[model samples]
Target: MTHPLVKRYNLAPHPEGGFYRQVFRSENETSSYIHGETRPALTHIYFLLLKGKVSRFHRVLHDEVWNHYEGAPLQLFQLHQQQLWERRIGGQGNEYAEVVNAGNYQAAQSMGEYSLVGCTVAPGFDFADFSFIEEPAMKQWLDIAHPDLAKFI
Candidate 1:
């Protein structure tokens, strides 16, 4: 089936060194994002995968819940006490589960989905959640891409 255009989300940097992202319809995995700091009560994130799956390899700085809006299926996992505990939350094992304390977990091709919504507390989520985790340390790219979001820090 023909899908929507793949989005190119790019955050800009500030004079000093920080990052920020535009707030837009998360479902619109095509083209859009708002400027300035946005803490949405329910910020939905859509992952348009080139392959059939997507990898959200990182940690949820703030406790959040994910609802699979659209995709093949989802395998949610988390790092609790430095241990990996996984489960097939989308198949027969369970249905519509929320991952907790997700840190350094590789949801690689396993994280199958084109879109998912991460609901957080009011005034919304900041950089703590935008971690493009490559390894142990956070790359801290947003700080250089969109300093505006980092300004809040």
Candidate 2:
């Protein structure tokens, strides 16, 4: 069954898995050296990850901040500086917000029924600036580095 939050937000399936609805896009634009293009100063979206679904590992050119809104805690994972890091957002003993640096590979999943979170990106977000990790290369790296994290791929 579809989660009520999904219906409330009218979210659409996201390419990375789960569902999302963009909530904000700043009208102000800025020239980003990181992206080499002018883009909205900020962008925000409501992201929902249902039980048993994962947000596949992906990277963006700008930093992303996630704010947990409701539902189960979200287990967010990041591959940064060749190290694997895990954080639980929302619920007991978990933080409400997390920041992922630019260029880090990130993924997440709900710890229970579902998780509703908001992601804010600086310099906005564009499909051109997003990319999923090549599975084979990521797998090879995981085999030598953090094999346990391979499930995220």
Off by over 4 Å in 2: 143-148
Angstrom error at residue 118, model 1? 5.3
Query: How well does candidate 2 match the true structure in TM-score terms?
Result: 0.93
Local distance difference test scores for all models: 0.40, 0.90
Worst lDDT window (10 residues) for model 2? Answer: 143-152
**Model 2 agreement with the true structure over 1-153: per-residue lDDT tens digits:** 778888999999999889999999999999876947999999999999999899988998999999999999999999865688899999998889999999899999999999999999999988889998876866688778876656567
Off by over 4 Å in 1: 1-42, 48-53, 91-93, 102-123, 132-153
Can you write out model 1's per-residue Cα lDDT over 14-128, one digit (the tens) per residue? 1212222334333322211333344454443433332343444455444455544444445544444435455554444466656454233334233443433223322244454
Candidate 2's clash total is 0
